[model samples]
Target: MELLRTKNLTKVYQQGKHTVNALTDCNIRIEQGEFVAIMGPSGSGKSTLLHLLGALDKPTDGNVWFDGKDMYSLPAEELARIRRQEIGQVFQDFQLIPIMSAYENIITPVLLDKQKPEKEYVEALAERLQIKDRLHHFPAELSGGQKQRVAIARALLMQPKLILADEPTGNLDKESAEEVLNLFIQAVKEAGSTLIMITHDAAIAERAGRVLRIDNGRVTG
Candidate 1:
């Protein structure tokens, strides 16, 4: 089943007097349980595509359909609801609250939505991510790997339809990166969720089932 798709997706940015095409005539689709990796250089619009795919930003001209529903056509509130409930995002810089503990951080989204966090499920997920013991610790206390693991746990807490990870392992050391990557992949598969990741490392990208190479605002592979 097609979980997410973009048709003729385009993004243009105007800087002062210059018009820049961040993404142009791009088209892509992701299957329901597939893992996809997006690779590109710094200015290749990789992040722009992710922002659009996740509905964080609007496309200049195109349509983004998630589960056959047009994302951009929805009202702002409805779109925000879907983004909160159906989509999960992980970033290179762990976006955790400085004052919140690991467990608190993991359940932040649920709390924001005015819902109660499922304790059992959250505990199990933390165990799976191997950060159960550190749940009480703050982000500043945990190592890079530990922090990323907590981020992964948070992303998977809601069992979102799609998990968007941007340079998830970019800050970790080799061993930690490998460990987190393995846990992340396994957890996503076990949850039967789709994953789309952006990385500049080919070796890391290889872990994905399919890779889409973006260059000059277009998919080259």
Candidate 2:
């Protein structure tokens, strides 16, 4: 039931003579339907690890496997397809298309893949996220919290195998932040989906089933 597994995963960035090792010899397993959080200070490879998990970037060494298939072993086109179908990402910046409404932004994946949106499931997700009424509104017309809710709804609309959130609530106020995190918890619990989140907030990290800290690319005590 390991939805995600990584072994001896490492990432090194060569900047002139000094080589920066973002991650090193790290191994972690996340079970299905689990909500896990990764926490660390800046430059601790928190984002790097999340990126690797989401297949956004390639690892310098070792392997990342989803189910039984090696993620990095796939061809670039296959990896892209897997990223779209199996993994969903919620970024801190709320990367919504400025011209698109909430509804359009959320279903862009389906449209791009030449598949029709599953209307019933998508509506349920929007209602759960409390963004049903705001579907027609552009990102510019929504509050910071509302935008994030829309982002969350979009991520869930696909019913993806795993969702990776990077500092999802970092830009919101306390109440808004709590609302977003609660929505994430509810989604994973209710839908039986897996989540891997990166956050610097200890309070938020405490809500996860498992919390692993990364420092100098290694899981720390």
Candidate 3:
């Protein structure tokens, strides 16, 4: 089934006197449980598109439909709720709380929702991601790969419908990158979640079931 759709999606930014068109008249559809990789060069509006799709920012023009609902048309509180409970995001920078242990970081979303953490599920997820041993370590104490794994676990903790990953392996070494990516793909597939990942590397893109290329803020494929 179609899980996400965008029509004439556009975003504009103003930097001083310059009007920057980050994205323009883009339309795309993503299906449930499909893995999609988006490729683009620097300043190509790849991240901008991801942010818009994930409901992190509002588009200047156009509409986004997630799960058959017009996301941009929803009220602010409803949109925020959908963003929190339905979409999961993983960043290249390993956006974990430095003060929290790896385990705490993984369960942060649940805590944010004011729900009790499901310890069994969290531990199983950590084990699957191979981060169970590192759970007690804080972000500062974990290696780059470990940190990213923790981030992935956090993203999957809520069993979100969509997972948005932005250059998730950019900070890791070749071996670690492959490891993390494999684990990530397996975890997402097992959860039957749709994945939209941004990757600059062609090799990485090839791993996805489908690839979408964006250039000058437009989706080329």
Of 1 and 2, which scores higher on TM-score?
1
Report, for every candidate in turn, its global Cα lDDT versus the true structure: 0.94, 0.88, 0.95
Rank candidates by lDDT, best first.
3, 1, 2
Cα displacement (Å) at residue 132, model 3: 0.7
lDDT of 3 by residue, 62-164 (tens): 9999999999999999998888889999999999999999999999999988899989999999999999999999999999999999999999999999999
lDDT tens digits, residue span 40-157, model 1: 9899999999999999999999999999999999999999998998899999998989999999999998998899999999999999999999999999999999999999988888
Off by over 4 Å in 3: none
List TM-scores for all candidates, in order: 0.98, 0.96, 0.99
Can you give the lDDT of residue 205 in candidate 2?
Answer: 83
What's the true lDDT of residue 127 in model 3? 98
Q: On residues 1-221, what C-alpha lDDT tens digit does candidate 2 reach at each position? A: 99989999999988999999999988999999998989888999999888898899889998999987899998989888888887888999899999999999999887877789987777788888888899999999999899998888878776788999999999999998998789778976787789989988989888888999888779884
Spell out the clash pairs found in candidate 2.
none
Model 2, position 219, has a per-residue lDDT of 88
Model 2 misplacement above 4 A? none
